[model samples]
Target: MSHTVVIKDIRNVTHDVKRIRLEKPSGYSFTPGQATEVAVDRDGWRDEKRPFTFTSLESDSVLEFIIKIYPDHDGVTEQIGQLTEGDSLIIGDPWGTIEYKEEGVFLAGGAGVTPFIAILRDLHNKGEIGNNQLIFSNKTEEDIILKNEFESILGSQFINVITREEPAGDHVFLDGEIGKDFLKSQINDFGQAFYVCGPDAFNESIMDALKELGADPEALVFEE
Candidate 1:
């Protein structure tokens, strides 16, 4: 089933990311970390659906999505970036494999952090964010989404890895990609649940490193 919802508000989260809020249909509900297919309500674009994770909690009055736009791709996300308030989007049923199993380390790369937004928010709201950690990697400091919010929610547990431009402050900077050596050095316990979300290459690399470190395969949660 699909619902046509009007955009209630739209704002920029970063240079290329947008935080969009839409009217929530009655009875609409979804778990944290879940996503839904969304299509522009415009004529020819109605069928060009893209999966976007819900950044809003299930109890929120409006549905929200934190989307990263690539204008160079000239794809759905680019069109989404141009959409303004009052625009309508066709949202499909909620579905996703990434969900919170327990307090653990969350590995996210770039835009992949979208799914974890709601999960962390839910935990923070319930005062159950105990010992949860977030290891977010981005090209630069400017590319990180909700940096302040994550820091507030997770405190010193929020880790940032920058691979491109040099970060300004005392943030951890990585010249190369996240590999076994880095993961092993940063994470001590390999027995906890590992929620990983990122580009294909990032996911594969992290999963392989975690498995090699003796992390239980079943405890590694990610979208398959």
Candidate 2:
């Protein structure tokens, strides 16, 4: 099913990342870590639809999405980045299987942390966030999305890795290049389910590393 959501606010989280707040329609329900297909009516790109994860908590009446816009990508993200308040867009019902478990480590790279934001927020509200750890990686400090928000919620349990600007922290090569030693240090149990999201190569590499670290194949979930 499709619904019309009006943009209520827009703010930049980073140079290329924007947070959009939308007016939730009546009778709409969504879980943390879920995503929806969005389409904005614009010339030459009215048919462009893309999946974006919700960043708002489940109890919130409004809907929010964190989007990273690459002017080079010819899709809804670019169009969405150009939108202003009061603009209306069509969005598919919430979908996705990446829901939060009772406890596990969240490994996200770049914008992949969008879905986890909602998950972490819900957990924080319920006092369940203390059991989970988040390891986020980006090319530079400026690339870290929702940095302050994550820190405020997860506190010292969150680990931020900046690969370019400094090497003082937990920096790794690319996602695929994340070593098993580093994975072991961050994740206490290989038996725990691993929730990973990122670009294609990033997801693949992390899943592969999880397997190498003795994680069960069936226990891994990556964004589709």
Q: Report the C-alpha lDDT of model 2 over 18-119, residue by residue, as the tens digit.
A: 999999988888898899988896667656788888988767888999999987876678788889999988888889758876588888889988888998
lDDT values, one for every candidate: 0.93, 0.83
Candidate 1 lDDT over 1-224, as tens digits, reads: 99999999999999999999999999999999999999999988899999999999999999999999999998889899999999999999999769899978999999999999999999999999998899999998889899999989998899999998789965789998888898888898999999999999999999999999999999999877
List residue ranges in candidate 1 displaced over 4 A: none
Candidate RMSDs in order = 0.8, 2.2
Clash total of candidate 1: 0
The lDDT, on a scale of 0 to 1, for candidate 2 is: 0.83
TM-score of 2: 0.92
lDDT of 1 at 55: 98
Residue pairs in steric clash, candidate 1? none
- The TM-score of candidate 1 is 0.98
